[model samples]
Target: MKKLFTIFVAAAAISAAAHATTAFTDAKDAVDYRQSAFTMIRHNTGDIGEMLQGKVPFDAKRVQQRTDALAALAPLPWPAFSTPGTESGGGDAKPEIWADFKDFTAKADKFQLDAKALQTAAQSGDQAKIKAAFAAFRGNCKACHDKYKAD
Candidate 1:
């Protein structure tokens, strides 16, 4: 069961990444792309959180799968931020994202780094390490969202 779940998670992540094309011909396409990428990121992280919180069993392989997905997905949303109307396009993104582009990119880069750490921890199969890495990754996400994403 664990192996199957791990395989499924990896397969799902690969499929999503494979299908995600950066053909942002327009603002709407960009918005959709970022939205889908973030949704996938959230889902994958939530899966790891579930295992950490014991809502699901601690399966190291599953953790690796989800974290691997997250590491890959983390960088996908930033390009969309450069698209037009990203701030006012009926999305939750705030105008500060563009106004403070340097800060935003820094935050995004931090998130990507933290996500990589989480992926490494997941691969290590140490629950304590995974928990700490997950917390750090979540903190990075929250910092960016607080500054850039609207309620």
Candidate 2:
């Protein structure tokens, strides 16, 4: 009976470990989640830029709405690459993400920082500050996409 109990415990432990390792079931799901998050970030940034540039009149309500959307997207839990049977599968993600993981993470971090700055500028309702922050935020996006997103 003790031996049987030990075997059951071992099985449970192994199962838990397997579940932990495969936090995402498939590569496509991972890619889709990432793309969705990026879309949110991009859309919000574009909206803010248009308002800042006077292409669209500043709408405080719309600015706050987009800012909240971006804040929600900022905390996405990106998966690690090459998980067993998983592959990036022609997504915009460049191979350098896995090849140079540290640099890739740095770029992502910079993007978040710039995004926060943009949000702050928007909140302040200062046109000049908004323009400057928008430029800074867009620059980070361009830098990262240039290196880490496939054309």
Candidate 3:
């Protein structure tokens, strides 16, 4: 059952990430895709946070599954910001993303790295490492949001 669930989650994330490579019809389409991908990422990460916080029981298998899902999801949303009209596509994203495209891209790259690090930490079965990694992984959200996402 756990294996099946993990496979399902992974496949779904990959299938969704696959869309990031496709061309968007317009800025709205890109914004929609980006938002959807971020939402899914949040849901999985939130589950892991809940486990760590004791809001939910710690299930190592579930943590692994969520991290695996995150690995696949991490690359999905960043490309959408590069979609031509997304600069003007309305969402929580601010104009600064395009204004500071290099920095934004670098931060997005760091986010992917953080996601991979979280997966490694979870697999190591080290509680302290996993907690530290989880905190670091979450830092990417705030880092980007503070500068690029709207108030």
lDDT of 1 by residue, 18-76 (tens): 55744244666678789999999989988888888999888898889898899899999
List, residue by residue over 5-44, the lDDT tens digit for candidate 2: 9999999999997766442666765676677777888888
The lDDT of each candidate is 0.85, 0.73, 0.91
Candidate 3 per-residue lDDT, tens place, 103-145, comes to 9999999999999999999999887898999999999999999
| Candidate 1 residue spans exceeding 4 A from truth | 1-23
TM-score of 2: 0.74
- In candidate 1, list every pair of residues with a backbone clash: none
TM-score of model 1 vs. true structure: 0.82
Pick the winner on TM-score between candidates 1 and 2. 1
Candidates sorted on TM-score, descending? 3, 1, 2
Alpha-carbon deviation at 43 in model 2, angstroms: 1.6
Alpha-carbon RMSD, each predicted model:
9.6, 6.8, 8.6
On TM-score, the leading prediction is 3
